[model samples]
Target: MSPVLPPALRGLPVAPVISHPVGQQTTVQPTTACELPQQSATGWLKEDSIASGVLIVLVLTGVQRLIGFVRSLLFCRWLEPDQLGQWDVAWGFLMLAAPLTVLSLPGTFGRYLEHYRAAGQLRVFLCRTAVVCLGLALVASGILLVMPEAFSWLIFGSGAQQQLIGPLAGTLLAVIAYNYLISLLTSLRTMRLVAVLETVNSAGFALAGGLLIYCWQRSAASAIVAYGSASLLCVVAATGWMQAIWQQAPQICPAIPQREFWAKLLPFAGWIMLVNLLTNLFMIADRYLVAQFAPGDSEARLALVGQYHSARVLPLLLASLASMLAAMILPHLSRDWEAGSRQQVSRRMNLGLKLLGLSLTAASAVLLLVAPLLFGLAFAGKYQQGLDILPWTLLSGVWFGAAALAQMYLWCAERAAKACLATALGLAVSVVLNLLLLPRMGLQGVVLAAA
Candidate 1:
């Protein structure tokens, strides 16, 4: 019925069908031609689950921070300047020591544990991390227990006013265990549990500290004992939670050999631990330096250190929010960067930096207005003298928090060496400034050095 068409124009030819015998099936899957999971419009923050996780962590952390602020306020109301100063210095030492006690497992554990969990090796990862932390904590606590006085000297030097070595060493051990358990739960994504741990810690501190002030002596030892008892209870609870998290972990597939797994963790964690220790040092170093270099008698210098610590509380409270955000974002940023999304990294950076600016600015302004009135009201007028130092200290915390956030990007990108070097550089500057300015300006000089 139709005219005969040329063979080439008749229809588009289909490719010849290819088939294989039963014995000729391909053995290896071709990964090169496949799209990566995190690409193709999928990403860390792009997922609903991840976004929700971050939000929940931030909210819970904010609640915990509020509780902590209340506890600190109560502590201020009860303790005098010299006592508070001694306590602050001791607490600073604990901060430096606590990270070391765990060998800096928390930050590094989250990254690897997340990967291991996805790979169905969570039990092995959790078991190994717990063992490592426990071993180190035991060793560290033994050393502290054997020579609490020597440890006290290392932290506060000679002529220390409140030499509560026994309680300090005991609290150190309890905190090390508590923190490790908390980190384990965080890696398990039991953020609510972590929040509860902090909530309980803060609430317990308030109840215990208030009780001690009301019934017992209002001294550094009493405060330490109160907090220590709270820490012990928390340690027990966290242990049970840790065990629960372990039970829920799927152990269907075997994990890698322990040596091979630890080899991967140690290199990453070693560098991070150094960075964390240095960062913590820089934070409380100013107070320690002021205590060391203030041009006055021991009692007077200690009082100044105490006042500076009081001023410092406001900034540290604001920094808690930033810390929560950074903690939540670290995993997301790591995933995004590893997925080759430089644009996402840049966006996160800008957003976080902006929030840091707004939060620090607003917090500083609010504190500037209320610092004098609140300090006088709550801290018995002893802290009003340091109102001038509060704003600058708060601003410096903004700087510190900003730097810490930047360092998180480095850690997620596996540039912990650079982060360590950067903190080392800051620590150097801090040392130089503290030495040069502290003698001339007293506590104000310490604030200047910190800034």
Candidate 2:
């Protein structure tokens, strides 16, 4: 008699009522457990991948240094002061040709191909890029042919002798191709392969150049030829290695080459190309300036060039290490940025800066301490002038390390415009300084120009 209910309602099952601790009735509501997204595992995996890449790059750096040191010893023992200076000039010309020729698109191709390969579209991208690189190489070579005198005049002036031209052009062609392959391997994150190629190429050059100097009693021109031959061999070897991988299964596609492949990277490529050009100017302008101003002063310039080259050895080695590290981290940063992973980006960036600083600092200290003795031991005794510029040139090394970090950030941020503008501005400044300084200061001026 407690409560009365309708007949139809009484047939329906009653909902369960639960009593709370507060003495209130409550209805039970079944709740499913909430699942939050987990990124820690993926983040850790990404970090491990980056660390692995860094380690590989460091190992490669060590390999490069060992090879380079050996080559330096050979150069010191075999070549005369004047010949080494001429050799430096020849390399300068080759560097100039590099940027104007496809604006270093081969490198861009490598970078882009790496990305596409990571995305599982390597064949399509690689095919397209290959065409572009080949075509561009041809076009660049053609342009050089027409304007041969232009660069020669700028670098060597009217005195650029006929004998050097062939060697120079040949060296440039091989260097351009070799650069592309090395860059491509780096992009693929195959540091060991890159290191192997570099080691092989360095050994080839060292042996060939040494032979030319020792056996043939050759001039600087012969050294140029040796370098060219070595570069060609390295390019061939790298290509063969790459092709071997394709032998398992091969497919054919449209002949769209680098032109099509580069389309995706036009924005960054443009700036990067310009930046590279400027960089070349900074590195090579000193040699060119010395050649231009000190045309009749070959003896003095030769000694100076030999020394500057020696002092630069350690810096270049460290720069390679920095560059390799930067290359590997770029992809990781790009990925993190795309995924809206701010924390990861910050962490990666910090790590990059630390690594760069540490490497550069250690390298600079060693270079500063041992450079004079090393220079004395490695080259003709005349190369002592390079010691004069070591401290300042070390600055360039640190700058490059920092710049590499900045560049990676720009790449990740997609700030190509800013990057290009900054690089262009820096290049312009360096060029202006080179013209102003080198004529007055000689090799010291060249060092200043480099800085």
Candidate 3:
């Protein structure tokens, strides 16, 4: 006597089945496509976890910047401007070489590693990435060793920088390898460990630099030795720690494919290479240009440029934290999008913006307010004359942080081409501006270009 079931319910016919008999209830049931796992305190979908993660990332980023600031101040007090300038020029060239060595692939490693982790294949991901990094490092090192003079003359002219060629080339491979390995752990979502490694590296560099200067006679060789050795040590410590954590708390399954990992990593690595090269080129080219075009006291001009550029460091550190937060949330965003969680994704985007905005605004304000005082303290009043760079540079932090966030979004969205385009444009603008402005404004021109 029960009414006929509608088409929508015809498959299960729950009403009719229930009306038939109580005993029949056990005989039939509606089919469910899937079941959700039990939610936990840190469930994947929760906003609270996202907020906490953002807060933690930002705080750690602040810590990293503070460490850098203190270290720079100490270095300035201990070393003369000309001495620091020489080190800076050598270091700038070294920074330029770094991206080339890795083919810039490690920059995007975190994104792919996130995908692998989400797919439950972590160990295979790490091993494969390591192989790619090592191979690239060795190749880059060999090339640098072969073409040492070409690099030396290009960055440091035919003068004293030629002397740095051996030391620079010798440690170049290890530095690149160490960086790639440290970055691998970061991709695995061990952010705390990543921050710790950076802190240790920074602290170690400062301590080593101090020891070399005051205790060991202000040798740039000693400073470089300490810096490279500390980087290698941190990489080793972090790698071992990551392996131990993996063993203790296995998070994902081994999913390395039968095909070699190098093949899979090459295309992505190439993209990373272009992105990093263009980005680093934009960052360091101005100093090189200053060294090239400044009419008198190239060292003084370079040091002035260094002072202005250093002002941006604190903001960059904070922005990096924002980038880290974005990176952490990206895999979750990708997973949610796949799972059709549109609402959750929107919420995450809004929350990420809000948190990042507040943190950046506050930091920028403090830097702007104390820029003169801080610059004076850090540079020992020698470069305090260029304090005007602080305000423009601090304001530029907003753009830097936003740009970084945008890059992260692009990276997660697999819009590397668009990210590259944006960066290329920014770099072009910077280069053109510097070329036009540096002769007129000298160090201030470089600051304008950087801004």
Candidate 4:
């Protein structure tokens, strides 16, 4: 017989439950009001399909790279070889320094943010790390402002371009903020937003920097200013959006203790910071060697660096793509690892490495085939030396991209220290090779060493 329903419950419809055989398990789908908030929160942080995520990143990255390539062509056309070389050195320094300044705290987001989110401490983690990153950036910027000449010598291989120090310092702060937002969004599996932000930054830089370079100053300083302005604007826009999202989010979970929080995060972040330093240093060491040790006057050496830069433009694009893939892949791998799907993580990583290797090799071949035409048409054949070494640069870039993909496994396993050691060894070898070869074979030797 049916039980008599209370007056308050009589008007509501009931959900039917079916009885099962002995030892059969029944699954209950929760439809209570209290469960709705939890479901919403889960959906907010749920991982996107890997296919969709990669597709979004690839499409947007391709667009961004196209704009960036055009910008590069314009810069190459407008600036003299030495002037272009100055910009390259300054730009590389900024890339290396921004990550270093913040001690790579943003890098931790991919591996740990999900863990924190599951524990209801995502906001706390984000806020604390952001404050620390900002403080470090401010301190680093202060140092740069106070000692521009010293850093100028450090970056340009001389103190004459000290004027750039001020611009670089300001830009570093903006870049730190920009990187933080990008990293945070990426870890949350918000690839579309990350791609959009990057596209905006690319478009802004190309439009503003091109105008400034062509119409106004026609110097590295102008490009620096434009970059900083775009980055700052992106940060401002992203922060506002994030604030609105956070306000609507349910925040009912108890916070994890500070001691436990730092205990897990700092070790991973420390190794990542070291690895980042070594990796950036490895990337730019060849250029620095050419700037400081190449057998020529400053003008001639810079001209050679400019030529090298042209050769590397396309090759570096491979590395950039690899980095994006690795960043996107890490979050998924971390989630799987956390869920104790360790073998599955390994299989996915293996498949990724193989695919990345093949794709990069094929791309390198195509780039090789088109090199001469690109040099003649786009570069106006001015960078003949760069054209000469295009094959070596392409090969180097392919290897580097593969290496970037390979390191994702290390990162996922919390063996970042091992990755750091490997990169440090590579950097040490690179330094020795550059030292030996730069004096002997000039730009070609440096290119070979990098390979």
Q: Which candidate is the best by lDDT?
A: 4
lDDT of 4 by residue, 1-451 (tens): 0111111101110101111222353443322322114324233334566688788878987899889988888877777678788888887787778867776677777666666665455567777898888899999999999999888778887778889899899988888888888877777787677778989999999898989988898787888898998899899888766774465344554556889878877766665565556666777788988988899787788888899999988887887777777766877887888788999998998899889889999999999889889888888778999999988998887787777777767666656457657877888888899899898998889988888
TM-score of each: 0.78, 0.71, 0.70, 0.79
Top candidate when judged by TM-score against the true structure:
4
TM-score for candidate 4, residues paired by index: 0.79
Comparing 3 with 4 on lDDT, the higher-scoring candidate is 4
Top-down lDDT ranking:
4, 1, 2, 3
Residue-by-residue lDDT tens digits, candidate 1, 1-451 = 0001001101100000011222353343223322222122122212235566666657766766787787788778888877777778777777777777776766565556666755556666777877877788778878877776676666665435435777877888777777666665555555556666767887888889889865898777788888788889988866654554555556455547878998877765665565566667767777788666677765676678778878878887767656656665777786787688989998998898788778778878888898878887877777765676887888777876786566567656555456557767878898899899888877778787778
- Can you write out model 2's per-residue Cα lDDT over 1-451, one digit (the tens) per residue? 0000101101000111111122243333211221221122222112234467667657756776777777767775576666676777777777666646655555454335534433345566655556766777777666656676675555555444545765676677777777766665655556556656777877888888878778886577778888889989988866665664343222433334566655666644554555555555555665666666653564665656666676677677667667666766776886788688978998989887887788788879977887767766665555566667878778787877778775777666756557656765766676677778776776677676656
Which candidate, 2 or 4, has the higher lDDT?
A: 4
C-alpha lDDT values of all predictions: 0.67, 0.61, 0.59, 0.75
Indicate the residue-level lDDT of 271 in model 2: 48
Residue-pair clashes per prediction, in order, are 0, 4, 1, 0
Question: On residues 1-451, what C-alpha lDDT tens digit does candidate 3 reach at each position?
Answer: 0011111101111122112232333332212311222222122222234455556556766776677777667666666655565566666666667756556566555445555544445456666656766787677767667787786666655444555666676666657766776565545555455556767877777777778778875544555666677777777776556555344333444445556555665665565556556666666677777766665664665566456545555565565555565555666776676577868777777777777777788888887777667667766676553466666665566666656554544544445567667778887888898889988987667777777
Model 2 sits at a Cα RMSD from the real structure of: 18.7
